[model samples]
Target chain A: AQSVTQLDSQVPVFEEAPVELRCNYSSSVSVYLFWYVQYPNQGLQLLLKYLSGSTLVKGINGFEAEFNKSQTSFHLRKPSVHISDTAEYFCAVTHMNTGFQKLVFGTGTRLLVSP
Target chain B: DVKVTQSSRYLVKRTGEKVFLECVQDMDHENMFWYRQDPGLGLRLIYFSYDVKMKEKGDIPEGYSVSREKKERFSLILESASTNQTSMYLCASRSGLAGGLYEQYFGPGTRLTVT
Candidate 1:
C-alpha cells in the first residue's frame, strides 16, 4: 500500500515570507504527485501535479513544487506568501497502474499567513 | 469548468439513523469517489465507483457503503450513524485515462454532525 506523509502540522509565517511545505511518499512503483489547497469551509482545489518529466513543477497562485525521485519527496514552495494564502494544504499520491486509481492524501499542513 | 455538487452543505442526524449523502457531477465523469475528512487526518477514501453500478472499497470502508446508479451521480450510505462518524464528507469525479493524466474534481463537501 502507498501512503503520503506531510511533516509539518502547522506553519505560521508573516506576509511576503517564503514558505515550503514538505511531503514524502512511500510507493514501490511509479506514482503521480499532487498538491491541493483548501480555503476555510471550502472544498479542495488542485494546486499542481507532477505526472511525468520536469522535476520542478509550477502550480497556481505563484506556487511550485520540486519532485525529488531519489528522496521520494515532493515539496511545495512559494517565493512569497500573502495573507490570502492562509489555508490548508494537502499532498497526495496515486499509482500509474490500472485499477481504481484511488488517491492517497497526507494529513495536511495548515499554512497560517498573517499580515 | 467541471462542477461537482453535494446534496447538502450541512446535515444534523441522530444516532442509529440511516444517512444518505448524495453527489452529482456535471462533467459526466467516469469515476466517482467518496471520502471522509477529519482534523489531523486528511481525506480517506471510503468508496469509489468506476462505472455505473460498479463500486470498489477504498482504504477505509468498514462502516460505510456507496451506490452509483448513474454515470454522473454517486451516493454514500451510512447504515447506522454514530458520533464517531461525524465528519466532512467529500465527493469527487474524474475522467478515465483516455484524457491523459486524470485529475479528480471535488465537491463543496457536506459536513455531517451526528448527535
Candidate 2:
C-alpha cells in the first residue's frame, strides 16, 4: 500500500514571493511521484513528475520539485508565485504494478496568493 | 490538446436516486479514470479502466460502480445517491508511453450535489 501526505493544508504567499509545498510518501517499493494543480472549479492538471534519473524535475508555469530519496520527500518549489497561481495543489504517488496505477493523494495544500 | 470530456458540468440529484456520470476521451488513450474531490480530502480514485470492458477498483469504490463499454468511454454509476456522495467528480486519461512515462490529461470536472 502507498500513502502520501502534504505537510501543510494551506500555504498563503504574496505575489512574486517564493513558495514551497511539502510532500512525503511511504511505500515499500519504487513509485512515481507527481504534483497536480487545480484552478477554481477546474479539474486537476499535471504539474510535474519524478520517475527516474535526475532528482530535480521542472514543470509547467516555472514550477519544479526535487525528489529526495533519503528524506522520502518530493517537495514543490516556485521561485516566484503569481496571483494566477492561487489554487489547490495535490501530491500523489502511483504504484507501478497493475497499470491500474492507483494515485494516492495528499489532503492537498491550498495556495493562496495575493497582491 | 488531449481532450477528456465529462458529460455533465453540474448535476443535482435527490437521495436514493440512481445517477450516472459519463466520461469520454478523444486521444485513443489506453487508460481512463474516475475520481471524486471533496473539501479537505483532495481527490480519491473511484475506478479506472485500462482497456475496453476492463475495470479495476480504486481507493474509494464503496459507493460507486463503473462501466467501460467502449475504448474511449468510462462511466461512473451511483447505485443510490446519498448526501455524502455529493462531490466534484473528475475524469482523466493517460497516453501510455515506453519507459513508463505517461502524462494524464483531465476533463473539466462535474460538480454533483446530492440533496
Candidate 3:
C-alpha cells in the first residue's frame, strides 16, 4: 500500500512571499505523484503532476513541485503567493504498475496567505 | 471541459436514515470515484467503479455501498447514516484509456450532516 505524508499541517505566510509544502511518500514500486488544491467550500483541483518526465513539474496557478526519487519526496512550491492562494493542499500518489488507478492522499496542508 | 457534478451541495439526514448521493460526469469517463473529506484527514476513497456494473471497495467502504448501472452516473449509498459518516463527500471521474495518464476531475462536493 502506498501512502503520502505531508510534513506540515499549516503554513502562514504574507502575500507575495514564497511558500513550500513538504510531502513524502512510501511505495514499493514506481509511482506517480500529484498535487491538488481545495478552496473554501469547493472540491479539489489538480495543481500539477509528475508522471515520467522531468523532475521539476509545473502546475496551474503559478505553482510547481520537484520530484526527488531518492528522498521519496514531492514538495509543492510557489515563488509568490496571493491571498487567493490560501487553501488546503493535498499530495497524492498512485502506483504505475497496476491498472487499478487508485490514489492515496496525504492528510493535507493548509496554506494561509495573509495580507 | 470535463465537468463532474453532484446531486447536492448540502444535505442533512438523521441517524439510521438511508442516504443516497448521486454523481454524474459529462466527459463520458470510464472511471468514477467517491471520496469523503474531513478536517485533518484528506480525501479517503470510499468506492470506485471502473465500468458499468463493476465496482471496487476502496480503503474505507464499510458503511457505504455504490451503484453504477450507467456509465456516466455513479451513486453512493449509506445503508444507515451515522454521525461518523457526516462529512464532505466528493465525486470524481477519470478516463481509463491506456497510454495516457488519467487525471481525476472532482466535483464541487456535497456536505452531509448526519444528526
Candidate 4:
C-alpha cells in the first residue's frame, strides 16, 4: 500500500519569509507526487506535481517542491510568502500505474502567514 | 477553464436524514471523484467513477455511497447523515487518457453540517 506523511500540522511564518512543508511517502512501486493547496471554504488546487522529471519542480504562486527519490520525500517550499498564501497544504502520492486508480494523501499542513 | 460545480455550497441536515450531494463537470473527462476535507486530516477520497454506471470505493467509504448515471455527473449519497459525517465535500475530475498526467479540476466544495 502507498501512504503519505506530512511532518507538520501547522507552520507559522511572517510575510516575506521563507517556509518549507515537509512530506514523505512510502510505496512499493514508483510514484507520482503532488502538492495541493486549499483556501478557506475552497476546494484544493494543484500546487505542483512530479511525474517523471527533474528533482526540482516549480509550480504556480511562486511555490516549488523538490522530489527527492533517495529520501522518499517531496517538500514544498516558498522563498517568500504573502499573507494571501496562508492556506492548508496537502501532499499526495499515487503509484506510476496505468490509468491511475488511487491517490493517497497525508494529513495537511496549515500555513499561517502573518504581517 | 475546466469547471467542476457542486450542487450546494453549504448544507445543514439532521442525523439519520438521507443526503445527496451532486457534482457536474463541464469537461468531457472520464473520471470523477468525491472527497471529504477535514481540518487536519486533509482530503480523504470517498468514492470515484471511471465511467457512467461504474463506481469504486476509496479509502474511506463506510458512511458514503456514490452514483454516476451519466458521464458528466456524479452524486454522493449518505444513507444516514451523522455528526461525524459533517465535512467539506470536494468534487474532482480528470481525463482518463494519457495516463492521467493532467491535473484534476476541483469544485468550490460543499460544506455539510450534520446535527
CA lDDT of each prediction against the hidden true structure: 0.93, 0.90, 0.94, 0.91
Model 2 quality (TM-score) = 0.95
| Clash list (residue pairs), candidate 2 | none
Docking class of 2: medium
Candidate 3 chain A, which ten residues in sequence have the lowest lDDT sum? Answer: A94-103
DockQ of 4: 0.71
* Candidate 1 lDDT tens digits, A4-57: 999999999999999999999999888989999999999999999999988999
The share of true interface contacts that also appear in candidate 4 amounts to 0.67
- Over B1-97, each residue of candidate 3 has an lDDT whose tens digit, in order, gives 9999999999999999999999999999998999999989999999999999999999899999999999999999999999999999999999988
DockQ of every model listed? Answer: 0.64, 0.62, 0.67, 0.71
In the order shown, the candidates' Cα RMSDs to the true structure are 1.2, 1.5, 1.1, 1.2
TM-score order, best first, reads 3, 1, 4, 2
User: Highest DockQ: which candidate?
Assistant: 4
Runs of candidate 3 with Cα error greater than 4 angstroms are none
Q: Candidate 4 at residue B46, lDDT?
A: 92
Candidate 1 residue runs with Cα over 4 Å from true position: B98-100
| Candidate with better TM-score, 3 vs 4 | 3
Interface RMSD of 1: 2.0
Worst ten in a row by lDDT for model 2 chain A: A94-103
Off by over 4 Å in 4: A98-100
Task: Write one digit per residue (lDDT tens) for candidate 3, span A5-85.
Answer: 998999999999999999999999888899999999998999999998899999999999999999999999999999999
Clashing pairs in 1: none
